[model samples]
Target chain A: MTTPSNKLPARAIIREVGLRDGLQSIATILSTAHKHTWIRAAYAAGQREIEVGSFVPARLLPQLADTAELVAYARTFPDLFVSVLVPNLRGAEDAIAANADLMIVPLSASHAHSLANLRKTPEDVVAEVARIRAARDAAGSRILIEGGVGTAFGCTLQGQVEKREVLRLMQALLDAGADRVSMADTVGYADPAMVRDLFEDALRIAGDRFWCGHFHDTRGLGLANVYAALEVGVTRFDACLAGIGGCPHAPGASGNVATEDLAYMLGSMGIQTGIDVQQLLALRAQAAQWLAGETLHGSLWQAGLPKTFTAAAAVAA
Target chain B: MTTPSNKLPARAIIREVGLRDGLQSIATILSTAHKHTWIRAAYAAGQREIEVGSFVPARLLPQLADTAELVAYARTFPDLFVSVLVPNLRGAEDAIAANADLMIVPLSASHAHSLANLRKTPEDVVAEVARIRAARDAAGSRILIEGGVGTAFGCTLQGQVEKREVLRLMQALLDAGADRVSMADTVGYADPAMVRDLFEDALRIAGDRFWCGHFHDTRGLGLANVYAALEVGVTRFDACLAGIGGCPHAPGASGNVATEDLAYMLGSMGIQTGIDVQQLLALRAQAAQWLAGETLHGSLWQAGLPKTFTAAAAVAA
Candidate 1:
């Protein structure tokens, strides 16, 4: 039997996405001042990478209308790599104007979902990536462009998305000039075996350009899927504080893997995440209070860190 | 890097412990009729092994006082391997009287937890297993004895449990006449790496005699820990329906990994669990109703099965 002990990487990155992916789905619109404080707390707690907000039109996602402001505030701290999600070239231009460190262009691999969610086909999104890449080069923007393939595992609308199609789109995005690529279990349809299989191939195709894994805890396999990705050597992950995101179609479903829970899992496994779990938990408590009426999900808040956990074992974030 | 692709077993056993471990910890006392129906549903849904209940004093766990009756009822179904938790020789005698297929004697590896929870040291419990084996032999019963090592990961009262001590006690239990042995993360302190490390050692020590893995979702690593155990070639696991159990010290902590979620994970991976997930969901809904007012946990019930799931791929129970 192959042991996964040697397969796991010593260090991993968790890009906080609560300010973007999380806030857009929920009803409660957090104020910019409150978001600034949240970002400050997150930065203080040892988070180095954060998806500050999305660059969608304010009328579309007013919750993240302050994406430029958040990116600016987050950039005040050195080494805090900031990212913003953009749907089309227009949103990409807004991100470029904001001088964001990176911009993620979401392309749904599922044909139906792509048209429904983004009002375009997968190929259309790929074409837009080429345009966005040209625009970035013309503007001399140093910001990285990431093609995030949503519903890469499976989709609620499309049911089953073929892995080949997902891979093809990823390759197309790379060919269209995306700086990096990643896969997301948009509706939590991914199981560990699927994650391992798809990601193994993804690693072979994209290699170091495979930026991150985004999983929704909608069906409770989020962390398990993360562990699977880790075994396959995909180190970077996207997490939301308090597990704040969810599918609007599936009520009572959870969002991304909870930041604190994921942090604890990595720390316990001796994987250097550089995020202080206690501080992250403190931030989770505050976020929970901020989004009180909205149902929050996670396990570590109630059962704090185990007594066996030693802060000395962890490296400074 | 060694790939975990081939390490996972194609089929695994999930021993339903909700009726025993789950019901005992909660305040609700389910009627014997309800439990009988629950067993019937579980049997129909494809569960072959079940820990009927504990053979403890009625006043202590009036919730499980109908254990003998449950065992008897469960035995009526041919091929249903019914097991019971026995604390001492007296409980073993009762289990023998009930004609149980197996009797598990729990031995906490943590000294403080052993004393506090069972009022016996680990050695004392090992000695009792020997006595229980002797009594079974004297009674001319063919019941299999399993020694379940709880807090094998770490403990709440005592900080860290040494791996050497845990393995030593496991060998001790076998030396004392246990037919099988298993380990449990009693307080949910284990991560996948720790699970893989310890379980690999356990498989080497016990070989085919290694019984099962029991994990609590207290900190949400239960399923991930299960995946790790699977990678180490441990096939059997303990789970509760709706995740009905918890650490009493932790107010809002979840109990065991939900049976349906575990089944889904195994099934999605091309593992043949024999149980129909749809039927299991039906049983979960009914059990949730029977144990109303209790905080239930699990993800599949809220979000129905992924469209990619195919029943033809599964073996019949």
Candidate 2:
């Protein structure tokens, strides 16, 4: 019960995945201008890190076909760290060509998910990360590489993924020359204790090279799990604006934790996440208009900020 | 990341506030039969504790006029601990007569809220708790007394509530002979650091006498605040099924954290809350149908459980 004077360090980074994760799952396709507005607004709200879009083939994901354009637009902000999801070496090339701050190569930990979705074994994806790293060095690109192990917990395709297997793949990714590695509860199977145990172990092996915690709010434990990771000194997270993504492969699964809500949680804890929650809610309203038919999720947007919120003064104090 | 073989002790208690908190706030007045059905189903779902109804005047809250009947029904379950909210001594008498397991007298820490909502000063409420305790002793009743300090963080009417004042009020309740005390972020202005600081101090003062953490998801930091409290060793929490019961005075405020969501969080974290989340979801479905126009808040209901979920089996493994 002793009051610890020093605030808990801000280890969590909420990367706004609204434009990519949110837009891709919904039936509606936002105009490129709307995407630009979202990116601008999110950055203005103190979101320095953002996954602006994905670098998949244009025809495969029409919702994100303007990723190249969005990437260019996001790069306009001086300190903003713009990232793009790259599925393969070709996508990596596109990301490198666009000069994204970071390019994440997602590898599903579930064998069934890897085979069915990516058409490659988990090890094969690690091999691709090696090739992508080689290509980046060959092309003299400075963009960072993040090997994201999706479904690191259990998976919709293959239930009960072994933690040992996830840890091995994570190590393999690092060994294969990945600049950083992240574990994701891609199907949202993680709970707080699991997050604490796994992240603590992963950090022991990967050190500061273990980058972010990606959790889906599919089963409502997203923020709880993130808090556990924070307790264990892992900072940086992947979140969608308005909690907008849904798993296409997993039936009845929802999106990542809402970025606005996550920001509010951090800001309330007196942790410096640098994101303005009010501005995030305003941005959500704007995004809602563009995504009229899409189901947007989040609690803070509907509730608004509490009267006692003095973020400007609190930060100054 | 050493996996600690020592299992986390089960500490969560979902104090169901639907009958009093949920029904009183909403326009719907469920039939007595429906209330009985809810109590029965909630108990069946492993919900050992329930706030069946309030003991306010029927004229003030006709929705809870069936409080006596509901309490009687709840007592039918041997292990179920039935609680009731009593605003003053008169209500306390009714609660004692019903042989309720617990009687919570809510006292707002915010002076403005105390005056406007409860028509009493903070000290006046403490005096009332003394009176209630005296009456209980005189009547030879063994009902547990709980002093719930609401608006402990901030209030809509009075913007910033000092931490010293909240702690003083909490100590006042204990001195006034209340069996237990708990803090509430009634206006949802709490951040994790603030929660940690206050709960830590309060726990030092109240020791094991501090019982529950009541948080509103109004600003979307409800789950995060709960986590902070957990870190400080709080286990029991107050949540509404479907996140119902917002303050009528606070226009944009949301309800308590969804009970089913909270249960899922605890269950997933390897903490035994004893409540079945799937059964809670089913109860939510019935509650939704009964309270059709009411805005229900929860994530697990919309997206359902994750594919990785194997009930208690996953956690056991």
Best by DockQ: 1
Per-model fnat list? 0.73, 0.59
Clashing residue pairs found in predicted model 2: A11-A235, A12-A236, A13-A236, A268-B191
In TM-score terms, candidate 1 sits at 0.98
- Model 2: runs farther than 4 Å from truth? A1-7, A10-12, A313-317, B1-8, B313-317
Worst 10 residues of 2 chain B by lDDT: B1-10
The DockQ-derived docking category for candidate 2 is medium
iRMS for model 1? 2.3
Query: TM-scores, in order shown?
Result: 0.98, 0.95
Q: Which structure among the candidates has the greatest TM-score?
A: 1
Q: Tens-digit lDDT track for model 1 on A1-317?
A: 55545478888999999998899899999999989989999988889999999988899888988899898899899899999999999999999999999999999999988887888999999999999999999999999999999999988887899999999999999999999999999888898889999999999999999999999988889999999999989999999999988655434445889999999999898888888999999988888888989988899998899998875545454
Share of native C-alpha contacts between chains A and B (below 8 angstroms) recovered by candidate 1 = 0.73
Cα-based lDDT for every prediction: 0.90, 0.84
